[model samples]
Target: MTDSENIKEIKKLGEEIMIGGVRFKSNVLMAPLAGYTCFPFRLMAERLGAGSAYTEMVSADALKYNDKATTKLLYTDAREKLKCVQLLGAVPTVFERAVKSDLIQKFDVIDINMGCPVPNVIKSGEGCSLMDDIPRASKIIESCKRSGKVVSVKCRIGMNPQRIVIEEFARMCESSGADMITVHGRTRNMMYDGEPLYEYIALAKRSVSIPVFANGGIDSKEKAEEMMEKTGADGVMLARYGFENPLAFSLLTGREINDTKLSLILEQIDIAEELFDELYVLTYIKKLASYFMKKQPGTKRYKLDLYKCGKVSELRELCTAIFGSDDNAGLV
Candidate 1:
């Protein structure tokens, strides 16, 4: 098929995917972003069109210690059909304990985050540092697999542009018992910038028999199609842009989305309020609204006003102003 034809063919209603016998409604999915992908956010993405979404990366260390704050992050509702939690850790024994923790026991899939590029995560011998240490990464995956839950993994192609380990790492994850893998087609040093190396993701896809989801820089329906076409991944996971543009899922996947920004924002507020205290709700919503704020015009003043607003009532008003402003009605 021509490039144009290929793009049109993959429009949203892509194939159903079976990962570890847990079938997803469609191939398109939402990737977890730290401090984002809260239950409400994940819910909105699912409502908008994503087949399933993972929670923000949870620290295995926190789970091991039974940290209240970390447990709070694992909250899920029955509304979400497929619940997945991503764990960030390097130690094999810690993962072994974490998979059995009550905090994440309800989750259907446990995703090991081996691709985080944050400096502190790297310094601690976690995240992308594990890419260079395949033996430890493999052991961690093996430990998590013991949970008897469908275990998956997310990782980068290599440590730097100079080092490409897609083929080797992909094989390791499969042999270590990962049911699926999401390959962010970039090195650790590239962070979130630069075009994702589609060829590398393709290499991983070909190297592994398990399902591989292509991640990184897929911000639009067209990009999702292109990523799938280029990498031959079973599906594409929407990340940064997916957080800000939940509508991308509906647009790409043929999922019906009757809700508007104002309606969804209101729903998120109600849910957030129920799960968190007033101060936490205000701060969390304020941080989340910032992403939406970047999408609207005339947000300069509201962005400044956002930090100062601390009450639920005040946050609702600020969000309404920035997201549901008169001049930006249609944009929302």
Candidate 2:
């Protein structure tokens, strides 16, 4: 088949594997990144054309106990399409309760996070630590499935290099009734350091009948295509890379990156300002601006000025000086 035909086939395959009867537009999913995949960021990714987007890992213990601060992380706009909430915790009962809560059912899918390697998470037998105890993980999966929600699990290959057990664990997740799985091709010990292990992800895909998405090390469209070719995963998930490039989904799906993307970013910032308070919007735009300015010429000075700004007006002025002020003329 021609390259265009091949791309069409892959994109179609992604749309057919529904999590809970909601169709994804593409197989390229924006992976949830803590502190970055907040509502505003997810909205940006969705507008950029990602098939689906996940929330950062919300603690089951916090949700079940009604911890206000933690519960806030689960908040989302009512209009978001293909919204999925990812819960993290090793306690089966707490996780089950959290998933069954009326609050969580508002989403299209419920994802169990087993891939986080943060010290606090792993120390509690959650995240990557769950890989060490396959039985407990299986029980959690079973309990979650009993909630009648479409269940998905995101996990790494192993707790460490010496404990490679993804293939075994993936089978247990499927047998325990998980509808889908996302494999980040690295041991917990590797953190986000090395290139993702495509072979390990491929192994997980081979062992499971359910759709397996490959996550990690995908930062560009060429790399995304290479990952699909190598691992045969049903989808690709972007984490930090998406934060650094909000237009990544469109770029990978064959859309060229031009002034149009830059314009979209500006419009997204405007929406973010309207959706959230001015203070929150400024902070979000400041964070995104740093990423956008990374390689742009003559942005260093503007970035420095932006870092010192205390209000939204200051940010807007800085953006105007750097990217041009006319709303109709695309940012250069």
Candidate maximizing TM-score:
1
Summarize candidate 2's per-residue lDDT along 30-76 as a digit string, tens digits. Answer: 88777667777777677677877889888877776766556556767
**Cα deviation of 22, candidate 2, in Å:** 3.3
Q: State in Å the error of residue 149, model 2.
A: 1.6
lDDT of each: 0.83, 0.78
58-139, model 1: which lDDT tens digit per residue? 8898886776688778988798888999999889999999888888899999999999999999988998899999999999
TM-score, structure 1 vs. true: 0.92
TM-score: model 2 vs. ground truth: 0.88
**What CA RMSD would you report for each candidate?**
2.8, 4.2
Kindly report which residue stretches of model 2 are placed more than 4 angstroms away from their true locations once superposed: 1-16, 65-68, 255-262, 325-332
Residue 128 Cα positional deviation in candidate 2, in Å, after optimal superposition: 0.5
